[model samples]
Target: MVSRPHGGRLVRRVLPRDRLEDILRDSRGLHQLDVDDTIYRDLENIGYGVYSPLTGFLDSVELESVLLTMRLSNDLPWTIPIVLDIDEEARRSIGIGDTVLLRYGGQPVGLLMVEEVYRYDKRLYAEKVFKTTDPAHPGVARVMSMGDYLVGGSVEYIPMVRDGYEDYFLTPMETRVLFRERGWETVVAFQTRNVPHLGHEYVQKTALTFVDGLFINPVIGRKKRGDFRDEVILEAYKTLINRFYPRGSVVMSIVRYAMRYAGPREAIHHAVMRKNFGATHFIVGRDHAGVGNYYGRYEAQEIFSEFPDLGITPLFFREFFYCRGCGGMSNEKICPHDRDLRIYISGTRIRESLSRGVVPPGEMMRREVAETILSFENPFVE
Candidate 1:
């Protein structure tokens, strides 16, 4: 059977449809705060049980504990803090024991029962979560741009944020049911924010050899510039799986959460999320969820050692590259090829080639996937 959700039970915080009207009517008297896209994604995860064991945004005490030790106040293995930041005016207007309607795109999506309103040190948060205080880092930049005050409270969802990919979005509960229906007792999840390359394919296929099902759960949230758009990613994966992967062996779904690029910590977060989705194993490859050189390439794989009973096994992989000596894609541990025989394609090279209207080599990405990527006019122009 698939593993239990992280921290035991799956949390379901969304109220029944019949009861939402009554809650909305009562919430009219409470303050309302419009959240940004990032905060909205966080709320969606919390309410949908993607971030189970977390009923709401973290209060100051929980936030501090997470930042300092990568654990929640309850000492569970939580890497990043789920916080709802607000401007000074909203902070002044809302206080402990008050209720606030959390809106996204000018629509009431949930209600936050306020528990704490506090200020945090952004630099400290950046350094603690991302191991950097430099604003050039996208994760750090996002941290620096956040509002000074954070509002913590349990959330009640009225309408979950779907972001136009509702058909591909599946909550943890839904995914577990799907796995059960497929008779997949052992499911391995592969997390991605980019279009699949040959290296990624290698990882997935490698995991498939051991598991009954492969779950491709891509992050469908706000990404940095030059990253593939959500639609492009979904379509590319569809093409990849339909043409290459065996039918009934793979499943694709969207996990709506902004990338934190917190490297090792983010890997933990990813594994925990997959565990919640009933995955018995998770793939942690080189620089998983990493952006730049801020983290060592293999740090994400190494981080899993810190959490012994994470309940989900981490399938660690080294950097995969085309080895001309072996005439196939191979990693350092298996291939004895020298540097001269190893062919590696960096994401920058692929992006540059795509921008120049050139398809990346089949060695790096499948020709079908590359053509799908090129179908868009400068797919990474954003």
Candidate 2:
């Protein structure tokens, strides 16, 4: 039995946290796709004050900014779920600032990881490492740190696709198979890339309002050039989770999937994958599967209506806009200033500020999250 932490109400449980921790630690070498904040907001319902610990120190204004960051990328699919085994003859390697592709049967299928590199204290850590960038390349990128030193840079990538590694890649349906086996009735999967922003906090809390348990799953794949490395992103999220979300309400995991800039369709693909991983419901939003306006505003939301046959549920939300009247999260309905209050932001604009070393507006992200995002280079422009 598995239990969830819901607003002072505790459910039944069979496996203890320590037991789960042990299982996770002992379980090594699994093929997976990684994700980030953008994917997280698109997958679940989250709200503020859900994680009380961090909320104590984080102001409501700051929290709203985080929510904006989460909403901005909410529609984009940041992960493609897969399963990897420990004993598999998986080839592994490491690098920085390069996108990886995972393919199957010579057709580009899905993403593995978006690579981002970070330098700190005389060492560079390839923080969030996961599997396959393109479906064509079923390789692995695992990050191992040695006492603050990053390791796993010299391993070779096994030709997963050509070498008959297809068996190792768990399709969405197969992921559902494993989730049912785990007995995790309700799984709340959280996504992110930059750091846990306030809007992100809202999205995760909002999701908990309806789910059984939460997975603060961030992407640790190859990233655009100049993006924050895995180590930095990892530390940022760990700090946010530790200081904020409930200990029992959330489980932190890394999705090894990469980003495909394909917003709406990709968003649908992500929800389906999460369903395969045992998620009963997934979050979707505006511009889902979009790249520079490649997708219509509601394309991602509209796409979900087509997937009822896939046996997955989607939580579609309008873009989380900041309203001056509400002084918090408000949509056009409640927000009288829809015309005046609506502010559209992009990773490009955020990166522009960061490349100049100026922290972006809290309206776009929490101060702390903004600090982290700004500290990194803008891989898109670079």
Candidate 3:
């Protein structure tokens, strides 16, 4: 049986197709709020049901609840607050019950029916959500740098902007239909921001062995310095799938959402998002969605135990490395090799090698993927 969507139904907030033009025409008179790429991505996901059960940006009450309890006011589990933040100038121009035009890159994209406009304590928000006030952590830094005022309301978006990778961008509804058509009742989703390593391949393929299909959904959004570019990740996965994977068993899609890198909480967030996308299971590997040394290696996996009815199973995998004794890629639980014979290549090592125009060892990354990384001009320079 297919997995049920979280909250029992997919929350699609986009205006109906026939009413879109009329809505756009009526939105011209509304106050306009120019948003950044992150908000734009949030709006797109909200409209498309990727962030299901969320009709709009979080209100003050909901945001507070999420920060304190990782649950919305309705008691649904939602770790991160998807609030439409704005500067004081923008906040002052809008009021309760006002409709605001949401624009991106100077072009109108949507309209937000402002319900609540409130100021937030940035440091407190950062500390609560990310469990730290240290600006060095990327998630905390992002929260600190965001606008002080947040606008809360339902959104009516125009058709999302298709920026070159339209074919790879599939909404939750579309993915559901695709899976049904392909006769894949049980689908496992593997979320990643990095390019595929052998460990990733192992996790995905292993997950596929039990499920009817595998969805390799890469997050194609703003990434930190030295991380693989969106295009590189797409091309590398394409190469890996085309050359190695069984046909019709796997599908690759791009999820355009900014990474919060909130460690264990973010893992639950990811699983919930995939659950909305018709996934029966989600891969939660070592340090999934973690950054730096803030979280324990298996903390992401452990978080799954807190929410038993998440509507999706979290497939946990221990640290994967190539063992000369096993003579193949193996996890710590399966490989009985000593540390001396294990060839462990961290993402840091692979990135450094790629930055210096060297391909990572074949045992760590596929030759095709490594060669693709080498073909790019200064892959990590950005």
Candidate 4:
């Protein structure tokens, strides 16, 4: 049995002290949270670049609101002060030791069972210190090389909310165990906070060609106002899988955790979390976890190469395009259609169409998916 701290206003969590210390040292970039230039500079100081999913979800105003949530909200169980992962004010409040129970549409869906905290050692950090003018100065190149060695493994634990214990779905461990027990050699997971589009179908189907199974996991937690309802997405997927995909080839489920929209970083974290749930691989595509052009098109793909220890191979698929020549959905190589022949349904454009009661074409969405979007109230519009 484990003990939990008491206090309605204070969030409580359990974490290893050594790991917490390393995280504090490694995450020094948090301080430069607001300024994009400074934030990137700090990331570079730590041997990384700045590109995240939150780029589109955050602006000056929203960033400040999230910052307040990080500092002032009691709902979060993790204790660390969320540093500037987004615009100056954008942040999340959960420290090292807390348990996060996630829900979707009033149903407990899953939990982020975090444990086994690892941090960067000062010795490793010391080894990387460089003196610009001194020949004896240590080279940071050494430190960057040891980043994975410093903190490479993950912890095992479960999440729960006191009053809603049963509602706290206990599937992370079971899911991992069951997948391993079965003969499924590879499982590739996809994360979504949006409705499925033609492009999504292309990726998931493409992933199925290589992996034994595909998990179409959609985040059903708190999302942007304009985002479609969880039920709509789920029902549409069900219709799609039944009519189009091979039976038992795809497993669609809801991942009801509030999104950080931290783009590339979030993609890494999502892949790691899915690995914890027993996925052997993840499908990452252009603008993954992205809202707008704040992060580059391929930034998420680039970040995966930076962390090789993850062991989860990111199957990077090219963007999908509708080729009039092929008369169906296709990727860059297979599609010979010119710019004028293609039809795209961006999140912004989809929402715009829905606001006016217009269903997007099969090019942007399937007929069933389009109908589903039209039936629902436009959260962004009303």
lDDT (0-100) at residue 250 of candidate 4? Answer: 72
Error of 1 at 375 (Å): 2.9
What RMSD does model 1 have? 1.7
lDDT of 1 by residue, 139-184 (tens): 8998899999998889976665446888888899999999999999
- Give per-residue CA lDDT, model 2, range 268-303, as digits (tens): 556644544556666665665454544578877775
| lDDT (Cα, tens digit) per residue for candidate 3, span 127-207 | 877878889998898888888898888997766566788889888999899999999999999988888899889888888
Residue 357 lDDT (model 4): 81
Kindly indicate the candidate among 3 and 4 with the higher TM-score.
Answer: 3
Model 3 per-residue lDDT at 117: 90
Model 4, 173-276: lDDT tens per residue? 44545455555678888877667788888889888898888777766544445667666676677778788898777767655444444456557656755654
Off by over 4 Å in 2: 1-184, 342-346, 371-382
**Ordering by TM-score:** 1, 3, 4, 2
Flag regions of model 1 displaced more than 4 Å: 25-27, 160-162
* For every candidate, C-alpha RMSD to the true structure in Å: 1.7, 17.6, 1.8, 14.9
Instruction: Quote the lDDT for 335 in model 3.
Output: 88
Candidate 1: residue pairs that collide: none
lDDT of each: 0.88, 0.44, 0.86, 0.50
Going through the candidates in order, what is the number of backbone clashes in each? 0, 75, 0, 16
